[model samples]
Target: MLLKEYRDYFKTELLPVYDEKEIDSFFYITLEAFHQMKRVDLVLKPDFELDGMQLLQWETVLHQLKEEKPIQYIFEETEFFGLPFYVNENVLIPRPETEELVEWIINSVPEIAGDRKIKILDIGTGSGCIAVSLAKNLPEAEVFAIDVSEKALEVARRNARQNEASVTFWHQDILNTDILSETFDIIVSNPPYVRNLEKQEIAKNVLDFEPHLALFVEDHDPLLFYRKITQLATKNLNRNGLLFFEINQYLGKEMEDLLQEYAFENIELRKDIYENDRMTKAVRKSYS
Candidate 1:
């Protein structure tokens, strides 16, 4: 079957489920993943063809898409912070807002000048996106990441190796731990902040296919992870150390309050590209 014909068929089948732009994105991304063909290649060779097996593969993906499966989970990979990461049902696919959190951390740190090395930790490091990205970009920092799920940690470890970013992975559950083993110069988390009541607002693809363990919190206590991490920060963060979080947009004010209650200084809440309050940063009080 010709690639162009298949593209049209793909679009038609998915038009009811997704918009034109998203369908095009899915099509080109799958084309590149499965056949190593870029959009320009398809345009150049208008008559490009797919063999029987390739057609079968595309058909399988089409069915999955129709069922609202995430393309990243279907492909078992994604790009975050311009770095390749392997993702699966065991971990949540990295989101763009979280990338913004990473950038905030990277920019907040001054360049290391001497033998001084900064230590960083990522709590709930699903897929290790934040930790790996920071390690890749800030080569001088010693990065550590922790996840409760062993399977999630497996994916995170592979991503660290794939990106050639040196990160230490821990399998401890942060909620169960009383204190971090070591103090960090910076700590960051994009932990489960979505309230149960907000599940209806989530897209079908995310609601159905993404790991809920990494995406949700009890509606009664939406800031569970943030509170615990902030408490830990008070004890485990170096003096004047920075803490960052990718927060639920609706709870930005609450997040700031939590940090303030913990006596963290210089708290700042920032919005993502969409102008939704999605991230927060605070400095550990020098006296604490």
Candidate 2:
């Protein structure tokens, strides 16, 4: 079966389930992942054939996509912050908004004291995207990550190793913990912020396939992770330390208020590429 032939199949079948652009993306991504074939290869060798077994696997994945399984999960890997991470049902797929959070941290390194090494911690690290990205990009910093799920931690550890980023992974529930063994210069969390009530807003692809343990909080306490992490940050951050969060767009004002209540100064909220208020940074103050 020629690869070009499948393009028509996708346009006819997948277009009903996914937009034309997404179908095109799936086609190219599947080609690259399975055959190491580039888009140019398809155009240049329009008659190039797919073996029977290859066509079988491609059809299988097409069914999964039609059921709204994410392309990332189907491939079991994704690129985040310009690095690759192994993902599974145990870990949530990293997002572009979270990459913006990481870029914010990387860009803020100049504000940190250059005389000493910066210490960074990522709470509820999931696939360890933030911790590994920071470790890889900010090599001078000491990076650590914690996740409650041992299964998720296994994926995070693999991601750190595969990315060659030195991040220490810990198994601990962020909400139950009160203190770290030592203080950090920067603590960041992109923890479970999606309230149960907001689950309807999530696409079936995510709601069905992603790990709920890493995505949700009680509807009544949408700020559960934020409040707990801020409390821990208060005691666990060094004076003048920084705190950052990839936040729920609907709860940005509540996040700011929570930071202010904790006396974290210079609170700033920033929008993601989609213009949603998606990231926040605050500074811990020193008492003279």
What is the Cα-based lDDT of residue 282 in candidate 2? 96
Tell me how many residue pairs clash in candidate 2: 0
Candidate 1 has a TM-score of 0.96
- Per-prediction TM-score, please? 0.96, 0.97
lDDT of each: 0.92, 0.91
Window of ten residues with lowest summed lDDT in model 1: 108-117
lDDT of 1 by residue, 109-223 (tens): 8832246889999999989999999999999899999999999999999999999999999999888889988999899999998899998899998998888999999999999
Query: Can you write out model 2's per-residue Cα lDDT over 1-288, one digit (the tens) per residue?
Result: 788988799768887788889998999999998889999988888888989999998999999999999999999989998898999999999999999899999999789858889999999999999999999998889999999999999999999999999999999987778778879999999988898889889999999999888899898999999999899888899998999999999999999999999889999999999999999999999632
Which candidate wins on lDDT? 1
Q: What is the lDDT of candidate 2?
A: 0.91
* Candidate 2 residue 118 C-alpha distance from true site, Å: 1.1
List ranges where model 2 is wrong by over 4 Å: none
RMSD of each: 1.5, 1.2
